[model samples]
Target: MCRTTVANPMMNEPWQRLPALSLKQLQYFVTLAQLRHFTDTASRLAISQPALSSALRQIETVLGVSWSTVPLRRSL
Candidate 1:
């Protein structure tokens, strides 16, 4: 009996550090993107507006972006 094993692509690739993004942060980003309004997004997420803003800021830091340059589709 002969057995052939397939090598995993990921196993051959160099290990890379991933961004420190959380599920909650992604949810915040998607909700804000859909609503296009900070207040509305916060309300929909059951979180405070300031908290939402802080989460976005964290996302910006992780992704190396500025909200002023992001064109969020609504006034922050």
Candidate 2:
């Protein structure tokens, strides 16, 4: 008999090109991605809209990618 454990993919940094990302920032990113609504995500995260935006910005800074704009909505 053998026992095996699967490692967490996110915890493994296969590449060292980008800076390390914090779990909080990733949470903000993932939450916003899932909800696609800043107000709702902010409410779910129990943080102000501005705080959510800030966390997202921090994530972008760490990854050096423009995940999305901070406006949170399109003026269509």
Q: Top lDDT: which candidate number?
A: 1
Backbone atom clashes (below 3 Å) for every candidate: 0, 0
Q: Which ranges of candidate 2 are over 4 A from the true structure?
A: 1-18, 69-76
RMSD of each: 6.8, 8.8
lDDT to native, each model = 0.84, 0.79
Single out the weakest 10-residue window by summed lDDT for candidate 2. 65-74
lDDT per residue as tens, model 1, 1-76: 9999997777654444456688999899898788877899999999998998899999999978887776767455
Candidate number of the best TM-score: 1
TM-score of each model, paired residue for residue: 0.69, 0.62
Clashes of 1: 0
Name model 1 segments beyond 4 Å from true.
1-18, 74-76
